[model samples]
Target: MDGKNALCRKCQDRLWDTRIPASSCERCKSYVEAGGVCRFCKNGGMEHIVSTYAPFMYTGAARTLVMQLKFRDMDDGLAYLTDAMADALPVRDFDLIVPVPLHARRERPRGCNQAQLLAQGVGVRICVPVGNALMRFRATSPQSTLASLRARRSNVENAFALCGDADISGKKILLVDDVRTSGSTARACAKVLLQGGAREVHLLCACVVWHYKGNEKNGSVAGKNGAAAGQHGR
Candidate 1:
């Protein structure tokens, strides 16, 4: 298999075959495949937190494509991501489609937003890609570090702001990002959208850290190291 297919296969295998339970919530179950809200959140009865849908887990073939797309600036790598995002997320009839924005300093050098590229791919299926709906307030340290969840949340707090008069009042908004880590960035961005008068914020990504909680499938196996396995931004 080629690079992209190989990456996807790895993801497929983990989600399907070697699925593991989330460490926290024992009631919630997740596999590497796709679909459904996080079982952990559901079992915990957390209302604020919603299920994050991802087509692939953050490992294997998915990791390779993400890395190349961000580092090598490989258009083909991006092509794979876009197609998957579109297949995974169909944002049709939504009041608006918003992509998480990058800081201007970072964006200038990259010349493109990975989230926007994903949005464009999804838009081909739904016909709506809002590129300038939101903006990052400032640059912050990567979430991989920050020691604790609280620190991660603080790292992204007030990190995003609405740009222009894109009225989303009582309108459904789709928030797109390349990946979902601790969900801190997504939460922070959702706060901005809620404050901007959006009726609701739905989260979508190409991949997310597999936090399966405690389902039988999740506990059955171990997850491979996804660190240094993928890249984000630019």
Candidate 2:
């Protein structure tokens, strides 16, 4: 769009408009019924995270963009994704930006980590440094293949370890990922960073799965600006 070869103007507009609505949970930004408790918060494991930010809901054109980048290895959409993510940052003084790690086996086949790509783009935009602070030492089932939230959580539990020589003591960190579904993966990674002496860990994702009440189908599955503009707090 806009003379870019990544997406058409119509697709770009559709992706940009897929922002999470005010009806979502105040803390985690997942869609919730009016006045209902946020299940992501009630489920716990997010106390280590300070806040979460994302630009679009995981549906429609947004999903397509994420799939293209993640599965198909098409990174043409990185510019658009990082632009939204940078705008979604609430604070600009983060000490470091860290991407959720993928086991070597998984990453070797892909030849690149989408999360790392997003992190590098965001780091450049925000004038922050990006590092490989954590390593996924254990290979686990993909969170998406799991049917339940507990299964997803269990899949990533203790799967991440802080890398040696990566001193994060008292440093604020921005954790980047492509998408957040059950939030299990982000919470798991955040716990590791916190235990490794990170002063604060904030989540930034390209898209987050949105749940709606009833049969309200907002859009098809597919896959931000400003801290106050997109931050979701607990």
Query: What is candidate 2's lDDT per residue for 1-234, written digit by digit as tens?
Result: 211446678888898678777677665666667844465566563557777788888776877687678767555688888888888776788999999888999898888898999999888888999999999999997655555555667788999999998889999999999877656788889899999999989899988766444212212111121121122211
Residue 155, model 1: Cα distance from true site in angstroms: 0.5
RMSD of candidates 1 onward, in order: 6.2, 6.6
Per-prediction TM-score, please?
0.73, 0.84
- What would the per-residue lDDT of candidate 1 be over residues 1-234, giving only the tens digit for each residue? 122463455455543432233332221223323445445354332223344445665666666566556556666566656655555553356677788888887778778878887776666666764656688978988665454445666787888888886677787777788776556677788778788888887776776655432422222122233343223311
Candidate 1 error regions (>4 Å)? 1-51, 212-234
Candidate 2 Cα misplacement greater than 4 A, ranges: 1-6, 33-37, 43-45, 73-75, 213-234
lDDT score, candidate 2: 0.74
The Cα RMSD in angstroms, rounded to one decimal, for candidate 2 relative to the true structure is 6.6
Scored by lDDT, the top model is 2
Number of backbone-clashing residue pairs for each candidate, in the order shown = 9, 11
- Among all windows of 10 consecutive residues in model 1, the one with the lowest summed lDDT is 215-224
